[model samples]
Target chain A: MIKKVLIAEDHESVNISVEKTLEELGMTQTDYVYYCDDALARIQKGVQDDQSYDLLITDLSFIKDSRVQKISGGLELIPAVRQVQPDLRIIVFSVSCIPSTIEMLFGQSDIDGYVCKGRNDAKALKEAIETVAKNQRYFPRHLTQKIRQKNVHDFTEYDIKIITLLANGMRQKDIPAYLIEEGTKPAGLSSIEKRLNYIKETLEFTKNEQLIAFCKDMGII
Target chain B: MIKKVLIAEDHESVNISVEKTLEELGMTQTDYVYYCDDALARIQKGVQDDQSYDLLITDLSFIKDSRVQKISGGLELIPAVRQVQPDLRIIVFSVSCIPSTIEMLFGQSDIDGYVCKGRNDAKALKEAIETVAKNQRYFPRHLTQKIRQKNVHDFTEYDIKIITLLANGMRQKDIPAYLIEEGTKPAGLSSIEKRLNYIKETLEFTKNEQLIAFCKDMGII
Candidate 1:
């Protein structure tokens, strides 16, 4: 049901493909820009004219050019656009496959959707726009699975501190001593071992090393 | 000085930019194709016609379209092109920032150079082409640092095996026993402890956990 949409992508081919996809969805009133600054300008102008874009499709990494602009990338542009038009829905279309980067966009930046630029991405982009238009969140299936896997193994702050210390090369017996010196309560060797064992059991990790590696990969530590 | 070059990039804008860079370098006889099949065919035909391309600049991931082709990605195309023209200097022009993937291309695939597509990449790509033309390997400053960091700590097959076991949730104490059962030599607890200590010391890692995490990130285990 969304009529007005704006796309901010640096690559002309990708920008054209996105425009084509929007056309396929029967969206005739679409605006496209190759720079973040231009996109922001259009949004600001739209707001001033009392005609705002319903959604914003953007690529996170824009190829830097000779032009000097306040907004260098899409991450910065998102919050800037949000401030001008709080009702605008945003979807990040990027090639960044890093889980931590994607997690930050979702958790911290509060993006409505993320569609990785890859094979069949045009299809994925179409689905994302349609879903986000209905005021719903959308993430690719693989990313959803990754987010779910991360959520399934919820680690407490205390658990994270202990594992982080272990990853930093602290011996198991030395942890309690360090914890006590740092004024943490229940800093007993037995308690530390019990807590670690409980966490390992819950996560189905057989070794402390594996648990540490998992935490590091998930950016929990 | 290199006179003839061939670029294999699907995106029209990137292809144009790469051609422009070549033009800047005074290399006018540049051929470009949007498909890997066309690239390989061009190389084959070039060889047959007694005029081979001096350089092959390509991107790793090509966006798939309705047309089905055998040589879909750059990894496959590199080996194919190498078979037809062994002396053709190759440089991967891509947006991929994964160190491990780049490491594999350099270490295993034996590519001449890699120029990441990012800020000031046109300059980097020009440098890469020049360096590779002189039979020298070229990786960007950051990528070279990553490759050096990887090489600084050379892990033996035995070291990798032990770390893989540890990462798979096997305890250090249980590793010796498992090694003995698996018919691995010097499976004594003392030898295992000594090897672990040596690896940690060499890598400047304080903990066995850190060692495991490092190995995982580097794709060693």
Candidate 2:
């Protein structure tokens, strides 16, 4: 029963594609805006007129122009719009994979679904709309895990350092010297090796390279 | 139709939780291994006996131990097992959100599905198993978009400088001096401003602060 979607995205191609996908999904009452300000204005007007969007699909990285008067991006906009129309379903459609941003959208906002942009966005967007329409939350499987694995509580600075060095293709032996030079909490080479060893053990890997690969793959760098 | 499941995660808590989730999903024949070595061994033995795992759920960050003669991590073991038993259903349960690593797993390895560790992992894991068992490739929705949005080929050195400056909370007017100090590219304030503008547009944001927020949230710093 969800209809009358509002899309707030900066890219023209993506806007068209999302609009097309919604049409393909039999949602023809969709409105589009290329700027965050315009989208906000439309949402405000829609609310005042009592003809608001059932869902607001936005991109989190929309930049402001000289004519624009918005303080936040799509990530922040979700809450902003929710203040006026608390019942409006919000879905984020972007190409960003950073766990921190996704956590903010899911953890802090009133968002019902998050759909990524590009090739899979079209398919996923349809799935997200359908899922949210039923009052169910849908985060893409891989992203949901990535966002949940943030480990903001117990992560150490050294852990982040090792991850960064490994990402830059530094060998295991060379990592210690680099860490020592950085000097935040310099430890001996053996200690550095041991720390990595411990990390690998904790994560379930044998090679230091796998640790590097996992750190790099997880964006711990 | 999938029943028996093999879990190859190093963490005791995570492994136990995964096992519990599988049991909740009506899977009673769940096998757990703490190291990458044991996992590979189980798969090899299973292959020889022609009773391999219906689903191989593993975290790719396993450590290297000398006593264990098996391969190092999930990346290595995935292909190794695939060589022996091409149809083995392999799902990588990881905490990584790196574009390169995920791309490699999706491109180089024929992994049936991937799930992340943490709160969302338990739920996503069940969905991944169900989806992959149905013979469909399941890429997490947010990550699928991130991978597609990855324009690895488009970044220049100036882009890095701009990203670094933005990550450091530099204002647009102050960027020209920083660019001059860095001296990588010689250009006017307009050029530096233009580059930032381009980056902002590319990411789809409405303000420099949003750009900063985006980079910070994505762990690009």
Candidate 3:
């Protein structure tokens, strides 16, 4: 039941292709603007007329220009539109892979999906629109993996201590005593050993030194 | 065939639950490391032993030292492991809502997936693991919306000019002249009109003046 789509893309070919894709997908009421300002203007007009765009598909980078614009790029445009039209579904279809930019866009906007340009992700692009329109998140396989890898590094205080102590060659039998002295409840020796053992087993390590070496290499110690 | 899972988490209760989850999933070969150091060491050892883990799941916010390790967080550990084991399937699980940070993790590192710590996203997290195991991307629905909303303000030079001209009451016939004088390929009269028409149609504008008013209000002029 998707009716209107607003695309804010600067590249003609990308724009044309996306438009065609939408049409092919039975989204014939697609509209496009080459820049952020025009795109916003169009969306606002639609809102005023009570016919707001159902979704917004945009590119990350635009041809740079030095003039007073409401915003500078897709990064800036996302927040503005969200403020005015919080319910609008959005999809970022771009070629850039700048993580910082992508993160900023995600944090500030209410986008529904993200897709990379080029042939490899074409099938993913169509699927992104359909998924986002249906209120589901659509991130290409690798991007999601990247997000997970980043999350793993966010450790807790206890985790840090365990890693540091393990790196220092402290035996599981001795860890509880040291932790208890520091006002932490002493875990059973078997529990401590089991935890370390689990670490070894899961990471596929035969000994503790390998884990220690990795910690040191990563500067986790 | 779910294989071994390496958990680099610090919390006792959480770690236990994760272990239980693994057991429930019929994955008894689970390893739990409470610190980043231990996690890395174990992973390396496993790699050396030719028994590398099938999955490396870690918390993103682990503390190395309660006081001295305040600044060094989980994010610092990704690149280290990636260098040694580029093929490792790493997933980051955390409670951070920072879009830029999430984007950086997803975009820069060799991560496989990111899952938030909230109850609402727990199901998504489980799905994320399954997706990553299958080498697919998984962006949580809420997270994607925030990222998209953050980047809508970015605009380009050409967009500024067309918007300014439109604001000045330049007729559609005059737009091509302005564009050509600016050393830009002037879109045909119909083209210019069509672009504007699309804008108006998307925004639901009945007249050109409304679009102009919107631009001025957004500071696009």
Best by lDDT: 1
- Model 2 residue A51 lDDT? 91
Which wins on TM-score, candidate 2 or candidate 3?
2
lDDT of each: 0.81, 0.68, 0.66
Window of ten residues with lowest summed lDDT in model 1 chain B: B212-221
- Stretch of 10 with least lDDT, candidate 1 chain A: A147-156
The candidates' DockQ values read 0.25, 0.02, 0.01
Supply the TM-score for candidate 1: 0.54
Looking at model 1, what is the TM-score of chain A? 0.67
For A1-85, candidate 3 gives per-residue lDDT tens digits of 5789998876553565577678779999999877799888988899999999999998766654454567667867888889888
Better of 1 and 3 by TM-score: 1
Which docking category, incorrect, acceptable, medium or high, applies to candidate 3?
Answer: incorrect
lDDT of 2 at A187: 55
TM-score: model 2 vs. ground truth: 0.39
Rank all candidate structures by their TM-score, best first, as comma-separated numbers.
1, 2, 3
Counting clashing residue pairs in each candidate, in order, gives 0, 24, 64
lDDT of 2 by residue, B7-106 (tens): 8876553565567667778888999887777787888898889888788888776534345645667777788777777877888887555565666677
